[model samples]
Target: MAIGDILVDVQAVAKHYGDGETRVDALRQVDLQVRAGEVIALLGPSGSGKTTLLNIIGCILDPSSGRVMLDGEPVFDGKWLRSDLRRLRLDKIGFIFQAHNLLPFLTAAENVSLVLDLAGWPADKGKERARELLDYLEVGHRAGVKPALLSGGEAQRVAIARALANRPRIILADEPTAALDSKRAQLVMDLLRKLATEQEASILTVTHDEKIFDRFDRLIHLRDGRLVDE
Candidate 1:
């Protein structure tokens, strides 16, 4: 891809935990580039560092060595600027985890609006956006419902709406479909693909479900903490 098309670039990145005898190399000279409007899947077995790499790219963790560039701007250069990292993560990146992580007491709309509230969005605007997102995700009927009242698929859809609330440039999802049934998993993957194309966002998702593998624009494999295929 051309330089201008790249939204995320990871260059020779490495991560290590502990030191000496207890040290574990979580990543090894990993290089990856994600372009705008692309959906890439990171496939690997458990403990293969998929989540580690996702965390690094999402600015949730620091790499021991190497660089990261987001939208042509350097975000990591051997050291992380904590404040900048936090700001960029909120403004430019969205994250989804295995769990919906919704605040159980909050209504669906309220849960989605919380993210906008953190970004300093006006209350009315945030609420409007939240509703729009929920509607778009086909969860509008559950806007006033709490997580405890929604089905698994409905809850996941709300989580996705919240993730897209900020219109982030990139999205990092770790096992986003793990809790869903096959049909729901396919629905989620299809939504992700649609988001990539319609929103022009780069998405990197880590998943072990081979059934949904064909939904991705590209597949990346990790083994022994290293990227073995792209």
Candidate 2:
């Protein structure tokens, strides 16, 4: 509502890879806004820049041109403004990748606790919060299990808990349900929607799971690195 209240904003953003004969435009003058307590789906085919846009928004990649402000803070103006971008990411942005990226040696609870600890939480508090999130996500029973021992759905849930351990303002998910079956995917989507609404955090997900598109507050379509509406 207010100017400083926007969770995520991208204005005239663009990204290109390679040079000359090998050039590829990953994003083209993209404009997007995500507000608190809302979930947005970036829907498009491969090469449509869905993930590219997500990366830009998450501060994983800098846009070639334009601006990206997170929670009213100008982190990028084509080039990153914050010298400690990694710290900013850890503090404000949570990331869920398709790979689940959990530490192989750590149990599910430990994986989640690691993040909280890194964010300056006390060891006991971090573990307690991790357990809380795991229970909230219905993964409490598997909290002691390792990634190799967990199902695709369980692993993903753990990854989500790890992402949320820091209580970030924004959650950026890239194909979060890619590894799950339809039923599990639906369950995850439902959980994501509920989390965004209940936590008052903004969620931006890049997904090809069209069956769950109706669950999101908004859907922004992309084609050939550009926004398109039907």
Candidate 3:
């Protein structure tokens, strides 16, 4: 894609459940554009279609209409454009959720390294890379600790390290800081902002917290499956 052009594009997208009169509109002609290295926030209340939009952007679900392009490729054209979306997901996207989701059996470093290994990186290199990322995120000291032994904030940081393990082109985080206190939430937001700017990765976050709204480059609000002016 050309520099400054959209790294992500969702044009006239819509999603629905059921059929005929019983249908529920989960998304309504939602049009969105994300540039590389920018952070965008999707804000809304419950049932506002924020998750639907994020799922579509992540290529986890297909839109009922319209199109989606990633890195200038037509990945979604109202249907499953690629047969191996799982591979694409593994290679191009990283996801963080409200919960840390780290395996209880693994150390912080292992959690990150495992993803790299699954992506075909050599074990030695993956371990080295994982260490680098954890250190960069300031969680290096917790590397040998497992989730059960780490604090909530520390586990969340490990989750972020895992998300960055594959060096994805886009990062989609759903309520990443929901479980943290204000101070920790601010720290996570700052880290996301820095990563987006420094790594040139497009980030779209779904969140209810208003405190970090100003940290985003763009904010899109949704209500009842429709876009509202922010």
Per-prediction TM-score, please?
Answer: 0.96, 0.95, 0.96
How far out, in Å, is residue 106 in model 1?
1.3
Question: Please, what are the lDDT tens digits per residue for candidate 2 over residues 1-230?
Answer: 33225799899999999999999999999888888888889998888999889888888887999999998798898689999878998998899989899999999999999988888889999999999999999999999998999988899999999988898889999999989998989899889888877777899999988888888888999999898962
Against the reference, the lDDT scores of all candidates come to: 0.91, 0.89, 0.90
Clashing pairs in 1: none
Q: Ranking under lDDT, best-scoring first?
A: 1, 3, 2
lDDT of 2: 0.89
Per-residue accuracy of model 1 over 1-230 as CA lDDT, tens digit each: 33239999999999999998999999999999999989999998888889999999998888999999987788888887456677788788988878988899899999999999999999999999999999999999999999999998999999999889999889999889999999999999999989888888999999989899999988999988899988
Worst 10 residues of 1 by lDDT: 1-10
lDDT of 3 by residue, 1-230 (tens): 43356888889999999999999999999888899888889988899999999999888877899899887788988677899998888888999989989999999999999999999999999999999999998999999998999988999999998998998878999999999998999999999989877777889999888888888988989998888976
RMSD in order of candidates: 1.7, 1.9, 1.3
> How does residue 111 of candidate 2 score in lDDT?
98
